[model samples]
Target: MSAPEIYEDGCPICKERLENGSDVVQIRQKGADGINAASVQRGDNVDVAAGCKAWLNEKFAPDLLETKQDVVDNMMLHLQNMDENLHKGHVGEPKSTIHQLELERLRFVLTSYLRSRLRKIEAYFPHLLDQQRNQTAEDPLRLSPDEYIFAEEYANNMSLYFRRVALRHMPTAQQKLDLSKTVAPPDLDAFVFLQVKDRQERVLIEEATDDQEEYVIDLEENSKHLMRYKPIAPLVSNGAVQLI
Candidate 1:
């Protein structure tokens, strides 16, 4: 896909910020056709491009990925700052329209990214909550703080509803809500399309049937492939590959 039209040099606010060195936003030239943008900070950089990729990955992945809290927070701050700047009349006419369009596009991405996560939470609350409860220090967080709260409440509400609606009338042994038997986990074996950002050697591809031999394949940088999500789940998490 061609790069999104959100980045434009015509905006006066961006131009002024660039001249004054007050705000730093840069479009990265390498990888994925220069679709990634970076928001440079003092100690760390918040990548808007990475955020966009994460949004796509979350949208396509069956399971919830880690929250890009920094990207979301930075982009929200950018939107607020631009809105305030526009109100102060720093940008005029066509340039203001450009700024407004950029803001709207960003807002759509941020909203949709969060919405996708919420949908996943609603669908697999039981499994997700269990995973959260059992997570170890080495494990990356699966849910943000707000999402964790939402999952807990959702699971409790569902359990309460089940009891009130049907379980109350059933035998005591049959009244318990066994989430493992009731809730379906995300299908790790589901096929997904992805582009390799970094070349990986001997990546194993498991066979769908016992009759077929499992094999390993090299994922060359920038190469695209259609494969099961399970083996490359770690790759997706680490940014070695991006889900398309």
Candidate 2:
């Protein structure tokens, strides 16, 4: 038996007004597929895009595998202990609030990592995946043989993202620009105030230009101050500070 069809006229993509009522086709579903919560909040300071770029570059240089993996693993495992402590006596996999929070923390680390690589894929091959490319393949940067196809495919999938990033070409300036173009890198250039969620020591001063200064700022609980958004990206990424 065929079920009765219900018709609702509107744009399917965004649910706004339809440009042409007769041209659009609407599909009717049997059941609702909505969730109570759809998105997860990761910290602001954690620069996954930066992490991604580092990982990709390291991949090309096989000798640094051990050193790179250690740094990456340490960052991801930072929250796993708390996650385990929160689920100490469970026989089955725990689905408690603490477990969810821990999962989110790990997710943030991975999300940032992947995002950073995509940023590189964009810069290194700015026009490779474009539908209407302004630059040629030889004009832009080239990825290694192992990375070329993957970077192109990944960049294609994240096309819309390239549009939203505020400063796309800035990061590639560090590289030889005869070929490199920064694609949709996450911007960490903003200067702003932040409030410390907990007591933190040795926070890098936002205004310091020299990395060799041995300068570190301490923040007491609930303390607020001006800082560069990038220096505190790790803190924000891990939920240590609140934007003010």
Candidate 3:
């Protein structure tokens, strides 16, 4: 998020001390001895009002500048934890090939999710700071900034399980059919197969019928291996196309 703008507070002493004009006034400064107050004598020739005004302005300006620095530090600290965790996930002793790929995938998923969510936050954060400062009626309908961040993190964590288990357990099956025909498999199966001609044109062909009995091949599901032979072009004929 872009840093919050700092607001400068009006000087207290200028408003309080110089409200009543005086040639000499007491200014307090603390030191080794507590409550070290001193009265600086000023002549009527000195424009004491302008000097007091400048002093108060100078004192408050640093405070206003420091507030912006504090906002930036706080934001950096908040994002730093996420960065450190993701970095640790990637760097370490060598792991098993499968385990390492899984870990990298998880890191990619989570970091991508965080970056996407942070982009949204950077867009909306100004309105949030305004709401906090203005003390307007809180909207019951909108998700707060904290709630939005939490929800995005939660979704990223949940998707890991979905990718690991649900996708891994996808079923594979083969069947033998009584007739020789090239068409889609029975509607009961999970997917449909296509034979790609060039990169663009695809010919929809049913899986080869099982030679043994009434069974049909699921070209789409079994085809995931990419190596096995179901010579698509070889199987093509007048009405039947090759099942590459």
Candidate 4:
């Protein structure tokens, strides 16, 4: 069965209780079979919305984006609260079933989002690690703390495996993993479908063919386009456009 519809009304489960002076927003869930609306806290709804957007961005971006640690953490907290509440309700109840379905859906989105980043890290660990090493204190971190550890361990293990399986047998001069020559970085020139969130002026589009001259175009707000990722990379990171 489909999950219940969540609206921005107030949450039914957590009432309007503020924690640590945090604003308490409410959400209304419309049951699948036209049952009455149920309330839920506003925090859960906001975090879930952010989590879904982050998921889509991670899925579409060629390079790994900054980790949305706060969004993930908040969503996880909400999921835990929902799970505890569900456990208190009887099985076979329509409300419980709806809650269960919605919980599963959120889990899937969060799982898929994390898995996408892990796959990218696995594919470009060496390059990603190098980037991490070179980043200054002011730069935003590309990997979360856990992910950074995973990438480091994965890089070390791969290096060891290569040495044991083949590198040791090579000539001493050749027994090295040259990351610059061995690792393939993500292709920023790849084309992506995106929707513009804000109007952008004089966005440059480099010519693919040598014979063609480069040109610039304006990206109107709310318009969709297929374009190469490189020139618009900053726009995506700054939330001006959403990759489809």
Worst 10 residues of 3 by lDDT: 30-39
RMSD of 4: 6.7
* Candidate 1, 112-204: lDDT as tens digits: 999999999999888888888999989988898889999989888988999999999999988878865798999999999999999999898
Model 2 TM: 0.29
Clashing pairs in model 1? none
In model 1, state the lDDT of residue 70: 75
lDDT of 2 at 97: 41
Question: Against the unseen true structure, what C-alpha lDDT does each candidate score?
Answer: 0.76, 0.46, 0.31, 0.76
Q: Alpha carbon lDDT of residue 60, candidate 3?
A: 22
Candidate 4 lDDT tens digits, 1-244: 8533433223334332333444333223222111111223233443455677789888998998888888788768867877998899888765566568777877898899999999999989888888899999988789999999999999889889989999999999999787556878998888999999999998988755688877889999999999898999889888899988
Q: Rank the models by TM-score, top first.
A: 1, 4, 2, 3
When superposed on Cα atoms, how far off is each prediction in RMSD? 5.2, 19.8, 32.0, 6.7
Q: Write the per-residue lDDT of candidate 3 for residues 38-103, one digit (tens) a residue.
A: 112211122222222222221222111001223223323423433444455445422222224333
Off by over 4 Å in 1: 1-13, 16-45, 90-92, 207-212
Winner on lDDT between 1 and 2 is 1
